[model samples]
Target chain A: MRRLSPPPTSKLVIFVVIAFFLLWWVPFSHVLPEGFPLRFGTYRTFQGSMIAMWAIVALGLNILTGYNGQISLGHSAFVAIGGYTAAILMVDYGWPFWTTIIIGGLIAGGIGFLIGVPALRLTGPYLAIATLGLALATPQILKKYDGLTHGTQGINVRPEVPASPDFIEDWFGIKLSNDEWIYFLALFIALLMLVLALNIVRSRVGRAFVAIRDSEIAAQAMGISVPRYKIIAFGISAFYGGIAGGTYAQVVGYVSPESFNFLLSINFLTTIVVGGLASILGSVLGATGLIVVPELPGIVSFIPGAGLPDELSWAFYGAALILVMIFAPYGLAGLFHRLVRVGPARVAGVLTPVQGAWLSWRERRRAPPASPGQTGAGSEDRSSGDQPGTE
Target chain B: MEEFWQQVVTGIATGSVYGLLALAIVLIYRSTSVLNFAQGEMAMLTTFVAWSILQWGEYWVMFPLVLVIAAGMGAFIERVIIRPVEGAPVLNIIIVTLGMFAILNNVATWRWGGIPKGFPAPPEIEVTGIRFMGEGALDIGPTVVSYHDLTILVFAVAIMVALYVFFQYTPLGLAMRATAQNPVASRLMGIRVGRMLTVGWALSATVGAVAGLLIAPLILLQPPMMMGVLLFAFAAAVLGGLDSPVGAVVGGLIIGVSENLVGTYTPKEWLGPDMKLTVTLLIIVVVLLIRPTGIFGRRAMRRV
Candidate 1:
């Protein structure tokens, strides 16, 4: 049977580019005249930037947890490192914002390398617990070392945050607000990192990371240096985390001990898992879902008789999480793939009866009835395991 | 010198609480290999139920009822939330638990509100005219231990021994152990593998309830009350070796004592009480560095 092949890579790239541009445009579009279509609030633009920033962290975390099979509950520590570094360099030493972000990433990556050496001795839940210890201690360490961290009050980076450059005003005939400027900066960084992640996962080093994740002894036999690649994965992942943290500093315009708490680390892990592990698309989807899903109740409240209390929002998020795990175990990415594979008509069969009937009637008329053997094969594929494709 | 002894004693009391929760963690990990991140929240929810029950009933009377409710909740969760993804990767199950963590914490906060409420400890009892458990301090050697602290210690040891006997001498316990060791073989041997797992969860939830009940009196009942304890308990469980109950308790004791000692003995200018948690965690990390499987955990062997 002939399989419907995926869209050409060039087409996929163009699609992504268009989608990303729209993501940037829609939120910032609120600056348009009152009657403009799809215009959103500045707050939405800020939220969109947050999504971009979180996606960067998710991409980094997926490299370690999804690709390399090392669980870390201490990523918040790395983020804190990056955030504090940027905050300190900008506030105290008066460094340029861009340079500080890069330096923050580099420092975080260096520390990640040091931590990864010890991490090599651990695996599975043990490694998770050890790293959790790091997360649990980070706040206290930050608070205690007030000389660097600015203690509990936290450092405000609002004054240090960069405004939109004059070049954009001259060239595009548009003046960007600070929020809009920051959003663009974050989106640019996120896109660059996303491209980097895509390449890294396809490279020889990425193969080694995957090989080791599948089996350490086998990877070793295959001539992959297990410790070295694991450490490198840690460094790369931390660098991404640091970059995201720096972005976070700019987006939120503050750096505090409480800002990079253990819950944030746990959320990062949750983002990757729910987005679809090991898939670059999954990371971005997960980040978007993490930021946007919680606000869904508020968004839906505009609908008549559909209002939900804000108190129940977290409970809704929790239920959504569990449902996602139960129904779409490979996360949103896997669900997307499944939908693409099975087509709308087949999916409709699982929906409401009236809709299913209408769709099936249309489907039957539009195309010949599928061969018996082909449909059977498709159902079998649906029942297969939850492991997301490494690609 | 007296201060050192006092810190050690105080540490033991708090450590007992950590150990109790860690024991609950180990029971589930032993059977299902899932680290229940929601353990503390489960306990917290039950303790809240106990608080609500106490409004209409006595403390001891509410205790057993709360345990039963906790057990039922545990079984329901395992069957409903956990059973479908039972064979998924460890990370997926952990995520499920994290989801449960959010749900339980949110529900408890929404239902009870976030205010700290006074939870009563087990009241003083007379066993053969010897007073046990009351509101007072007992002078022991160099330390003055609170009655509540002693009560926690007593309850911790009792639960440990009871669990030991239950797992050692009982046929059901043996079956559960068999299930943990090799579920397929246990199934072939006519053991109800699924039932054993459900029971393991029930047992764990019950143990967790006891920990929550005991700790609540000291810390005051609140939604986020158990978050800190849960982290320490996780540390204890990992430190003790996830599969070993005894290890959990010992690890808790070690962590508790060291935490207190570090806070008390460290320099006031730089590494005093404020830095105690950081220091303790550093020490735990160092220990983990030396023994990756933890001090008591058996090294896992896998075939390629």
Candidate 2:
């Protein structure tokens, strides 16, 4: 069936170029033509960059949870570590932002590797429980080391590449804020990480990760070095999370213990699940949902005692998650991929109720009608076990 | 040394609450093999229900009503939200629970503002009194254990023993165990798998509500009150082994005591009560590293 098969490579290239230009407009949104919506300028760009940061984290989570099947609810711990590391280095020693980012990612990866060692023996739920402890403790641990973490006041990183004030004359002869500069920084890194993640997942190591996920014993028997691969996957996933953290620090110019809480980790997990686990594009879509869906509460503001947006957003978000999981466990990316694989024919047949009924009627008229409730051969046998109580 | 003894007793008390919550967690895990992350929030919401009922000043009525409310809510959640995704991957189940956690917490806050409320102290606390605990306190040098702490320890132990008897001696308990062990076989054996599962959830939630009720007096009654307790209880479950009730209780006691001791001994210049959560995390890591399946949990055998 036709899927409006992704436009030709050339068209795709043009589309990407156009998108880049549009992104470039985000920082200077305040100066755009009158009556343009989403003209919050720096705020919009900041929010957009936040989506990118979340995408990076979600991509990392997808590798560990979606692909490797090792659940780490404490991913926020890795991210917090990375963010704190970068912020401290930048604030204290005045290290370059890029250096801090690399160092932070490595440090977080090292921690993840250490965690993965013990995680080797833990199954799905158990691993999650362990990580849950880690996530919950992270903020306190950071606060405990007040000498480094500044005791919850947190550290603010000075942007090494702060936008210069040049009267709109030196750079682009147009007034653009530092937010745009940071957005590109995050976007560029996100794209690079996306490519790297895709390459890693498609490579031989990726297959080993998948193998261990399906069955560690089988993977070990196949000589895949299950423990080594598990540790490596965990490290790589943490690396992405740390990178996102560093990116977040650079974008926000601040690092606080409260920023990377268990709720954040839950959001990352929700992103992966809602976007489509194990799919590259799922990360981006999930990130978008994370940022956009909360505004949904605005629609129901008319309800009495609805409270503020932040107060009620989580309820709606949770409801959305439950509904989505119940109906589309494979997430949006999987649904799209399947639709493409099945082509448009089956999809079209499922829709257009009139045609479906007419076709069935025609077939019924051409042949004798089958006995009611005994039509299908597979339906001849029903499990003797009682059905689940619907009430 | 006296301070240490007092802290140990206090830890036992706090640990008992954690133990109760951990028991609920273990029960749910036993039945469904999935961690109910929302267990704490569900309990918190119900505790609020009890709080509201108590506001009407019907103490005895509140107890049974709260249990019934919690049981109904638990059964409803299992039958509706959880049943559909029973065969899905563990991660999906985790996500659902996380969602429930968020939903329940936010809904609770919306219904009853985020401000801290003073939980009406149970009359039993005053009736039994701190004097009884003082008499039971083993006087070690200058440190005398507080009766409040002693009461908590005794309360937790009593509940654990009661649960033990219920699980070991009751036919329904045996059926529940059978269902947990093998759902298909249990179904074929004329045991209702769905009913057992719903019952497991209901019982677990009810237990968690009791934990919440007990904990509320210790902490402030607020929408976010149970978040930290839940994490600690989760740690206790892991340390004790996720599938073992006794393990949960022991793990809770150990964690609670250690938490108090660490907070007291750790230097203010270095670490404080703020960092006590790290101790729980360290225990989980150490236990997982040493025993993997937890000291009490049965080691899982994998088939390829």
Please report the candidate that would top lDDT against the real structure.
1
Against the unseen true structure, what C-alpha lDDT does each candidate score?
A: 0.87, 0.78
Q: List where candidate 2 sits over 4 angstroms from the true fold.
A: A1-28, A158-161, A164-175, A299-311, A339-391, B125-151
lDDT tens digits by residue: candidate 2, B1-304? 7778778877888998898899899999988888888999999999899988887767667878998999999999999989999887767787899889989999999999989887753444334543343223456465766554555566667767877787789988889999998889999999988999999999999889888877887798998898878887888888898888899999999899889988898877667677777875776677787887777999986654
Model 2 chain A: weakest 10-residue lDDT segment is: A382-391
TM-scores of all candidate predictions against the true structure: 0.94, 0.86
- Interface alpha-carbon RMSD, every candidate: 1.0, 1.8
Give the Cα-based TM-score of candidate 1 against the true structure: 0.94
DockQ for each of the predicted structures, in order? 0.76, 0.67
TM-score of chain B of each: 0.97, 0.91
Worst-scoring 10-residue span by lDDT in model 1 chain B: B295-304
First chain TM-score, candidate 1:
0.89
